[model samples]
Target: MIQKLKDKGINVIAIEGNHDRLFDFEDLSWLDHLKRENLLILLRPSVRDGKIFFDEWDGERGGMIKMGNLRFYGIGYQGVNNSEYVERLGELLDPSFENVVIVHSAIGGSSMGLMPGFSKIEEFIPLSKKCEYVAAGHAHEKKIYEIEGTKIFIPGAPEYWDLSENGEKGFFIYDTEDKTYTFIESKKRKKIERKIMLQNGSEGEFSAAFSMAVDENPVEKDSIYSITIEVPYGVFCNVNLAGVEQKLEELGALKGRVVTKWIGQDSNLPDSSDDLDIERQIISADPSLGNYAPEISKAIDKLKDLHRSGDTDQSSMVIDDLLDQIIGEDGI
Candidate 1:
């Protein structure tokens, strides 16, 4: 694909998603290879504050490239909203010449999910309107929209396919001279959907349901597939999750790749149990806070012990001492 784009005399930029850093180690390792070969420009996400750092690329995001009467302004995935960086991009845009903005990360999916909020695009759109078109990737579905008169294009994933059955996998080509965009969709790929229900039944019945679900949705040996199962809670209580996983593997229904998730009510709950509600509240809260609350509570308990052991008094004398310190009435 890189060679094909190059043959068309178009500059190709490759952007990395968070997932690419994981299972796709070879691509991450080949960053320098692309740079050396001059085949494509590679942009990677920066780590900062538990999210991709957008500010690190403020002064060093993209460079200017001249293509015929068009001036392509490249922006990395970072610093899309910084005022100074946006102003810098604005300065690069010339009214006399057509402009194209090439970006790796657009405002969707991983970029949107990982970022704190959705305000960067607002800051970028105004400056981007000065350009003829904006080409972006990272979104797994192709999309084109006009924001503030700027044509925003997301070509979607090139070869990476989505597990969702409805996902569109494709690429885009923009003719700089004619200001036209073309989307090329991949060949039709086979998709399979499997649903299994394991109600109050014997072990053999449950096993047969699982087997039939797999058989009914056999995946093409070469096609990508996804499986979603809705199992009532406690169905797996006596049954081994690992054993079920092995059974699915034996069925060979996932074409070597399988992603399974469970969704259902906690049918295993007792009618008089209070544990579920309290546990649910803690589980639903912010994960970071949930992790720290127990430690904070433990510290408070220790402080209470100190006070109860006569290390500190909670009466008029203590209040008087505190007031004296506040007024600087006590000696330092």
Candidate 2:
């Protein structure tokens, strides 16, 4: 894709995200390989003795890129944890050119689900006063926030990364001189979520509610869809979830999931039983969790069992493992 963009005389300047950093083989990453091939200008700042420093393009340090009169400074996933490095952003830019700072971090007024390794918007304050614009990632919601003279632009994920994510998927083109931005919607797949609340989990009740939901908001062709069925805990067995999802597949959806939400259930449910509401709630709380919700839900079940057994030590171990799994080995 970068090659295609380059072929048309368009330069793709990029910064490595948390996911991109994992694609490393030997010592060089896929991003490094692309930069070496001149397909994309990958900008990554250097950290020496806990201090951040940017190198010139000719030096191949990838901290800065100059296109015409605009200067773009990038601090990729590596800078997310270091407050000192991020605070020094203004000092790293040249005053002569129009400055733009880009980083892959959760930059907003508040903590985004209290997720690990995300810098808050306040950390960019010093740089915001000096830089003309700020482009941030790691938060999949599209928004713009201004601090001082700088306008922070988060274009959001180009595609729906989670069922919780809704609205238009797009990119932004900013006019550096005019301080204006024009959003261009990407030709991305749509994500549709529908809920069917059942008074009784009988097949008739399921059919009526499901058909009504489909009639009101007909599923789009080749779109990702999720139909959540809410039923009482005891009656969930009556609803054929597999058949429900299969009907969605037959209706021309690219991918479909039939998630169950058991309502009116006591917290003392058996451990052997599935508490799908926990998984749904986890994903709803932080959509970036994606498919990890199942594993997390299983861990929660284990913790619950341990608690019932009065094994505090075992419960602590299970919690530690869950935290490590979610936040990586590095506990924040």
Clashes of each: 1, 0
The regions of model 2 sitting more than 4 angstroms off are 23-27, 79-82, 108-113, 215-220, 232-243, 262-332
How close is each model in CA RMSD to the real structure?
14.0, 9.0
- lDDT (tens digit, per residue) of candidate 1 on 94-177: 777887666655453221122211124665655655887777654556777666878778766644443543656676777776
Q: What is the lDDT of residue 33 in candidate 2?
A: 81
**Candidate 2 colliding pairs, count:** 0
Q: Which candidate should be chosen as best, given lDDT against the real structure?
A: 2
Q: Best candidate, TM-score-wise?
A: 2
Instruction: Please report how far candidate 1 places residue 97 from its true position, in Å.
Output: 1.6
Report residue 194 deviation for candidate 1 (angstroms).
1.4
